[model samples]
Target: MALRLKDQLVGQVVDGRYEVLSRIAAGGMATVYLAADARLGRQVALKVMHPHLAADEVFVDRFAREARSAARLSHPGVVGVYDQGAEGGTVYLAMEHVPGRTLRDVLTERGALTAGEALAVVTAMLDALASAHRSDLVHRDVKPENILVGLDGRLRVADFGLARAASASTTAASVLIGTVAYLAPELVTQGRADARADVYAVGVVLFELLTGSLPFTGDVPAQVAYAHV
Candidate 1:
């Protein structure tokens, strides 16, 4: 397997608490690692921002603060956030380590799912999102890639890198966050997100599960963004 530069911390320790074991997956914003928590004597998934992204003090501080808030959210369907810390310039979140494949992987391997199966998958995701909504947290980015299917066949919603509270829209996000295919229309135009935005993304996810394709198609991101608008 090809190793990413961010995955180079395979055997290193973070904040003197978590010991990185192996790389799990890398995403557009962060790379997740399987790690052992030395203080707690347990396993945790450590999600660290890419060095380049972590370099921005504004982004890093926001990430750390949001992660700390997410840690207070308790729900079975939502992947738990355990701890958040920054060592040097590397910011990381210690999360509940779940052994699973992403919904994207499932869709790639097996095209469209039956209505019942699709409902089960999406229902679980909505459950997680619903919990977040109740907590005033809007998962701004909800896509197949952010939906995890566990080894035991349970579904859990993961990734809150772009999540924001309903009341925290005082300023727009610095960058256009989230996968374009699943982005809600209002998020692109007004730069505001809320529970309804997550609901929109959940609808898009359901459509993908049922149809085996996205609702909008475009050769470039701008085209998709335009379509969303």
Candidate 2:
């Protein structure tokens, strides 16, 4: 079944500044919403951390750090994070709203893309990853679902929600958090990732875009993990 935002989030206000309009996407640690910025008079993408993650001190610290660091990065291909804070019990990030569909959505509808189109999308995503890498940030999650193609055909990488500073801890949990199909082998085997890891993910995405199937797939997480090997 197609995921619907309304079924995931309804009546959630983040930080009292971003009024959640509707759910856009849901992930393991957070839920993204199309929200209205009460003070700014504009639309914004609000990411509210899952209550379990929000209650974890380490996760909260990492979330705020990544939000602040991502905000410092100014690139057309990278989603801009404007604010990060907590209110009531919600921890959220207010980011620039890109009006378009995710690469995953496009792939789901079209099946596969032409070689040229696939290259275009991958190139844009790599550029964004390069920028993040240069700034010592690693987008732990790099997949079609995290890349958005705006109306102008510009690709913007979203969901820095899973990003962690290069200096942060790389535990087994972190390695398993990203999408199984697009995860780099190094991430799975060593719990270590860098710019090259991002490159590997882009390659996996390209493979999917060209073949309409993942390089690896299985019925369960363990089976998927073994497929990566």
Highest lDDT against the true fold, candidate = 1
RMSD of each: 3.2, 3.4
Per-residue lDDT for 12-124 in model 2, tens only? 55666777788777776567889999999999988776666666767677777778888898899999989999876677888999988999899999999999988888888
Candidate 2 least-lDDT 10 residues: 165-174
TM-score, structure 2 vs. true: 0.88
Model 1's TM-score against the true structure = 0.91
* lDDT (Cα, tens digit) per residue for candidate 1, span 99-183: 9899999999998999999988878888888888888877888888888888999888887644442113333232343377787
Model 2, runs deviating above 4 Å: 1-13, 161-178
- Model 1: lDDT of residue 221: 74
List ranges where model 1 is wrong by over 4 Å: 1-7, 161-178
Candidate 2 residue 198 C-alpha distance from true site, Å: 0.7
